[model samples]
Target: MRRIAVPWGVLALWVAVLALAGPFAGKLGDVQHNRAVDYLPASADSTQVAKIQDRLPGGETTELVLVYHREGGLSSADRAAAAEQVADIDRKLSLVRTPEGVPSRSGDTVMYPVASTGPGQDEKARDAFVNDVRDLAHDTGAGLSVDVGGPGALATDASEVYQSLDGPLLYTTVAVVALLLILIYRSPFLWLVPLAVAGVADFLSMGVAYGLNQAFGTTISGQSQGVMTILVFGAGTDYALLIVARYREELRRFERPYDAMRAALRGCGPAVLASSATVAAGLLCLLAADLNSSRGMGPLGAVGVLCALVAMLTLLPAVLVLLGRRVFWPLVPAFGSRPKERRSLFTAMGSSAGRRPLTVLGVGAVLLGALALGAFALPGSLKQEDSFTDRPDSVVAMRTLAAAYPEASSQPITVIAPTGKATEAVATARDTDGVTDVTRGRSGSGWTEINVVAKAAPQTAAETATIEALRDGLDGRGAYVGGPSAEQLDLKDTNARDRLVVVPIVLAAVLLILVVLLRSLVAPLLLLAAVVAVWGAALGIGGLVFGPLFGFEGTDPGLGLLSFVFLVALGVDYGIFLMHRMREEVLGGAPTGAAALTALRTTGAVIASAGLVLAATFAVLTSMPLVQLVELGFVIAVGVLLDTFLVRTYLVTSASYALGRKVWWPGPLSRRLPGAPAAPPAEEPALTRTP
Candidate 1:
């Protein structure tokens, strides 16, 4: 396969354009429109409803509660200082004027609305506000606690967490990539090339993500940002490593550097392309999800993977062609040495398992089945308050609210009935099961606001049931319930829609890619089956660890869905790597058992090493402070390990051995095409080798 310079240039240009356009891209528009609509009161007439919405607080403004304690409740001095600090912060924040004006009030307890001015305009204002508040509380001799229970606070806390993780994540990713390259190549210059490619890939991916956000009006949350960074680094490095490793091996067979590069591309390009396609397709499946975050993540992540692949195939090779043998300087080579035949541990395992494919397959099936026992038992609730670290101001405030006014801690449900009908609706709703109180508010043209207070947390089962009951009771009466609890109900409904839509889409995409690459319907089906099993097992394990083992009462309802997406995408890596080796062995004319052995010995080491790196990179998320990060980190890490060790090693080997030559049946794609040599090609002469 020849390298195309034009495509490479075009890709570079496209990346440049995205970079230039980055700042102009507007923030991700809200994808949760239904959630907002669900919160409107049912009693208001259409016109009044619109007017009320117009006067309501902007979506960005959130009511924040700052809490502090002194020995004898709140001392006068402490109250005075805290009040002043709140006022100053409010004044400074006033510069960030949103569509809905900031409401300010002062007394023993200060209350105000904080507006988000995007990432632009006084970037340091929020930080400064937080610091100033903390300092004042300290100076006043009060045990300070700031509870930010508003949307703005959530955004602020998320940003802080990402910023905190960014530095360490970057450093760790780079260090890990460099270490891997150094071990693989032993040449400093050669090792640096792939890192450089990965860096470029990162910049290009981020630029594209920014542009996509602009074009599609999708919001890129803090979680997405952090995951994108780690993914770009890890995936880019892995792709580059595979290409470079193949290049070195090919160079051992050819006299010319260009020939070696071509040879490597011919052997590795198809595999890399296939692998990239599977992952990208898997990510693209997120488009089917109802959540804006999930849907946006799919395309953004796919773009990142595509950029990495382009760099690996084009830029890296072009640089290698230019550098020639000098790329591996300080190394000298001797000609005519016998080609080394590495031991195949995977092949041995494959052969042994091949003789017992059913047993191996059955074992894997049982393990996954057992793990999946926890699937139905998994809890599904959104604990936004606990999403952040307990130490965060928002979390603290939420906790305090839960203690002081449990009823008010959750979002208020606004039940709307026609102005004249609100009294009857309010009276009926107030008496409804699960409702703690129902307060009637200003009524307009045939509409009234009936505030329905729930007896449980907004995200709890009881609240959801209550919301449903209220909606059912007021059906066709222009009744609309809007508030935080209603929003949760909408989110839950949306998530359910996503699960139904995304899983099949991803599965089909992955299967299609595998079929095209492997040229065997049977193999793709089996591989997909393995991936599904691994995904289920991962979720089950996560449920056990987080749900029961760790005693985490809160639920990350989206965890299972997210795990499915990630495992299907990433788990394919091991399968592709191993299967490619098996094909190569077959092309070399090894008998079924011998070929499997050869594949295991030669490719097994690389897969194991790569899996280790990938798993470790994912495992780093455990150190992050947020619950989502920790859960995501553990699930992906464990899933990758299972894919690498159990599914790829034992299960695949067993199947391949059991099928023997039949594994490649029904397609000439497995056979070398016209003009391609059948026997193992002669080893290329080494251009250079380091002692």
Candidate 2:
């Protein structure tokens, strides 16, 4: 009666949940803000100027540059073709200002700086306009190459890439998890239960994330949403793996399925709880971030993990109990039937570490340190145009314009000033260092807009200096200088500041949580230090490969901070599982060395599977079209692998063995009783504990 009622109740609850989640989950993609200014730090001058521009007369112009070129030089026919196309664009699109062609010095290229307010402030409408222009330019041009490049085109291209990612990312992630589960379980029927539950968790997360946006005005970006999906499949599957493995073990001890699941949950529940709590607490730390995208990702990601935890802990258990041992089918764990006792890979690894714990620990440390040095080889900060892994039309256009218009501004610097100070601001901008030209446009409410062009190319170091000079020059006149170049500059600076402020906070927060859970100062610090080393080594590996092998131009500014947060948060998860087992064995009266080896032997395979699932999920990002996503995926994936095979398996086990009971310093386990039986030697198996 109990099993029957519980399974039916759990199934019914999930049915109701899916029904409610379907609608909101479908709508989550609709609220994503992928525009350049949308991702900028809130207090940035670029953000302020963009807001002021949005409230102006036309509500921000959709500006573009249409470049026409012939390799040798423009002929009579080329010039005629260029004019006819420009005229068609003006007539069909109804430009806000009719652009006159500006010819290059070599007569090989002509550029038209076209502006239109037909889209107003709607991102979708603006995308449509940019797409239309690109289509016409590509479809109509004859014997001349036409490319549309500017902020508007770049934003549209980026949105298109982001929009396309949802389907492929989901499919690829699901396939990867399914394949891994099939191999690990070696049962044709067993893998689907956990996979299906993970899918439910992912859908639930999407709905909750959408709710977060509507209620709290959380900034939902494509990047954040993509990450949430990965966490659901990755972390959810991890929890499912641990529970199912424990349930199988308990099945051998208990006669009834319900009784077996009860004992299993009681055994593994605290470890799973502590693991998820560490991950959520670390993600919640993202709230202190300055960038809207990074800050918003924290709450949304935490929601994913907690939602997954609920589904795995409640729904998966109920369903598995109802299915009974038959779900294991070809390899069922019957009542009193135990797994074959034999030598395994993890057992062999434990044996090796036992022989020379210090030697094993020292060699592993040196290898990780060597990997850490590769970070110095990484490329510089990634440019906006180089952010995408594939070359979109916008990127191609920008590259072409860069070559065609060297030492000439391809993009303008935007300045917003008080309408009363407009004239004086324009005069100051004109006389400022590095300013080649300035033009005033669009006055409304109490502010005015000015477009200034520097002699240096867009986003070049010289142009960056020019932007700073203008902002400093007009600081007292109620002016804000902003544009693509300024936004990139702000992004770089704010990421540095955010890392300085947030890294320590994340470390301290995760450290506190570990200390609380483990009830030991030395153990938590050791775990934190181990994860930090993994992060460095992983980053260094990325530095060595990202440029020469992957062809990425530069690293994303926020990559370091984000990678640190995730590695420390998620890496500590496996540490918690092992340490919890160790603690359990120790408190149950197992000697220190025996307990450490037993814990390693019992939990090693599960940690390896969980690590593979997690690393594979993040590795899915390496196949994404954005370089930043790819880089993040590579670093995190590599870091997880290192933590699994090297840090968790060997270094941690070695450190535990070498320290004896001292590893749990200040904890009750660290002190031995005066009259207890003599402890077994390190060579003996810890018969007192078993999986």
Candidate 3:
């Protein structure tokens, strides 16, 4: 009666919590922002420029370029039509000035540069203006085509892709997890339990995330929210797997469902808690990053992992206990019924690895090292046009402009100077090397805005040099030089600096967590070393594939750092699970060799399943239109797979086997008991237990 009442009480409590969580969760999407300014560090020159622009009259301008092109030379009619459209746009939209058409040297292409400040800082208004322009700038259909582009249009397109990510990414991730669970459990009702709980966890995380944003003004982005959802599902499902596996095993030994659950929690709760703590701790290290996106992701990711942990440990267990052994359906484990004994796949692999630990260790290390060499082949920082996997109108426009205006920049390098020093700043900017032209516009709020054009195109090294020169020349002159090109330059430099700071913090945090959990210095080091190797190898694989196979023009600036944080943190989870079980076996009187093999034999399948689920969740990001998400997803997913199969199964296991008791060095287990034999006793028959 008490057991039944407890389960009912928990269900009622969850219902109340969900009722509260439901509203806030729906509001999370409302607070999400994907603007380029949102991702930049507040201290960056580009961010300061954006902020100041918002304060000036008419607000930040939305710049656009209307590309009018024909395969052959543009006829007089085409030019006239282009002019008429530009005139209509100027009349209909609130333009900074009437746009003038610039014809290409080939006489086949013409571009009309447009700018409007009517939208101010309102994203909806800005998007509406872009859409209105796109509608008004219709193609001639007879040969002449039009593409509305530039930084503003590119931002709109990126926002749309980000907006689309929420629905499809969630559904795809859910479907993938459901399918995998169906296959892994082979039970009709079993998969639904964990999936439902994960959904609830996701709902809860969203609510918490929204509250954090509102209360603390934490920056929220599409990437961070999407990743939060993934963590809620991926990490949530992993905790579920470990819990359910232990619960299933306990059900066979205990008479009542409540007792069985209690035993199961005692068995696996430490590992699950430690796993979530490690992930949360490691993700929290991202707070040290100077990049706004990375910094925001830290809290959001930690929130996700912590929420998943709570749900899996509490709601999942209560629901499962209430359902009792019958939840497993046809394959339900009856009380006192032993699982089938057979030589499983993990048994064979473990035996082989244990037989030649050094050989297996050396070979696996070499394979990972060889893969790491491919990192050298990775492309440079991704340019704006190449950021999208699908070529939208904005990308097309940029490409067309690049081909047509081979030597000139269509984008402006914006410099904001003190109103008092505007004259001096203008003269200095005009005199700066690579400066093709300079125009002074908009003066208010103690600042004057200046637009400078470069001889080189946007994001090119020459343009980068010009931006640097502007910053250097303007140093202490109370002027800020920034624009799309300057923003990219700042982003690249900031990401590089962030890697140096965040990597060491993440490593120390994760290593400390591992040491505390394993109670052995050597064991934690081995696990950390294995996961780091996996990160490098996974990135190497991306290098080999991203450019040649995927046709990606460049890598995302944040890829290496983000991937390392995820891989090292998430990758170490499997190690903890395996090592935890090995420790358990050793404490249960099994010798070191027997324990390593035994842990692998018992837990490998579930670890592999968890790995598959996590990898697949991230793999869904590959299906996204954004190249950054795709690159990040591909690297992390590959790293998880490598960690699960190769590093955890082969290297860590073999290293432990070879090290014997020394794997537990600095712990009591490092020394043999008084009566223990030098050599371990024969191994016991392996059980084919799986969850």
Q: Candidate 2 has what TM-score?
A: 0.97
lDDT of 2 by residue, 123-217 (tens): 89999999899877863445578889888888888888899889999999999999999988888988999999999999999999999999998
Model 1 alpha-carbon miss at residue 88, Å: 9.7
Using TM-score as the measure, which candidate wins?
A: 3
lDDT of 1 by residue, 428-512 (tens): 7977788887777545444565657687765677777887888778777767775555654565566677788888888888877
Select the stronger candidate by TM-score from 2 and 3.
Answer: 3
For candidate 3, the lDDT comes to 0.90
Mark the regions of model 1 whose C-alpha exceeds 4 Å error after superposition: 1-61, 66-152, 162-168, 326-344, 351-357, 374-380, 404-410, 414-429, 438-451, 547-551, 584-593, 661-691
Order of candidate numbers by lDDT, starting with the best = 3, 2, 1
What residue runs in model 3 are displaced by over 4 Å at the alpha carbon?
677-691
Cα misplacement distance, residue 428 of candidate 2 (Å): 2.0
Residue 317 error for model 3, in Å?
1.3
TM per candidate: 0.79, 0.97, 0.97
Report the candidate with higher TM-score, 1 versus 2: 2
Candidate 1: deviation at residue 10, Å? 10
| Candidate 1 TM-score to native | 0.79
Minimal lDDT window, size 10, model 3: 679-688
> Would you give me the overall lDDT of model 1?
0.64
